[model samples]
Target: MNDKKKKSDTNSSAENVEQHLQELEKADYERLYYSQEQTFSADELARSINEQRLTELMAKSDEFLKSLNSELEDFDD
Candidate 1:
């Protein structure tokens, strides 16, 4: 019974994390889509470029974190 409960709890937590990540991904995609759609003057274009850089930086950050986590898992045995 305890093992079953533990498994259930783990699954529930995993589902929650997956949902949150999906929400964040959707929001990021929405922002990127709008950024691509909107018109920008020269100054606005510079601002847009900065915003895109920030977005790319965030994606890189997530990738780095995921890679680090996977590497740490490999050392866990």
Candidate 2:
């Protein structure tokens, strides 16, 4: 009888744990799917703008390099 009671208690505890886990999973799913989502917070927007400016600078640098390469090729007679 004592062994049976111990087994029942273990099973009850396991079921309770499983129920709590399920609740947590459901909450997570709801948050993932239904949460109000904004892609760009203010800090994120500032970083994006900075990156865009850096990319424009890099493109200008590439164009300058190409022009310099063409000038060098012209002198390779």
Candidate 3:
């Protein structure tokens, strides 16, 4: 009886995981996460803005976004 209960629990867990994955795949994630470029006017803004290193931050954020999607793909497998 205990063996049967364990098997039943395993199957239920697998089914729940599969259902969650299906729901995840159905989401419009791209539209939900779309990022448009931002622009600011004026050649001379705050010195702090110039020193913020936006270029390096953008590069790092892009890499982070790519890794996020790759992590989801890993879960799919």
Candidate 4:
């Protein structure tokens, strides 16, 4: 009977440890997920800003090209 009691106690202790480890793993996973999500959001914002800047640059380039073409025509005549 004493041996049986000892076995039961050991099993219970093992189960408790396993449960605690699972909980810790879950918490770690949640933290990592949120961290990655925030990083992705920041990357998206940066990409958007860069796209806007490129668009503005393209517009300015078009205007400059048009002016240069006009000057070239005037010089030819």
Best by lDDT: 1
Q: Write model 2 residue lDDT over 1-77, tens digit each, in one string.
A: 99988877778777989989999999998898875574768887686677877899999999999999999999996
Which stretch of 10 consecutive residues in model 3 shows the poorest summed lDDT?
30-39
Q: For model 3, how does the per-residue alpha-carbon lDDT over 2-77 read when each residue is reduced to its tens digit?
A: 9988877778777988988888876656445552344555654564475558888988999999999999999999
In the predicted model 3, the residue pairs found to clash are: none
lDDT of 2 at 47: 68
Question: What are the models' TM-scores?
Answer: 0.41, 0.37, 0.38, 0.38
Task: Let me know the TM-score candidate 1 reaches against the reference structure.
Answer: 0.41
Better model by lDDT: candidate 3 vs candidate 4: 4
Clashing pairs in 2: none
Top TM-score model: 1
In angstroms, the error of model 1 at 8 is 12
In model 1, pairs of residues that clash are none
Winner by TM-score between candidate 2 and candidate 1:
1
- Positional deviation of 60 in candidate 3, in angstroms? 0.5
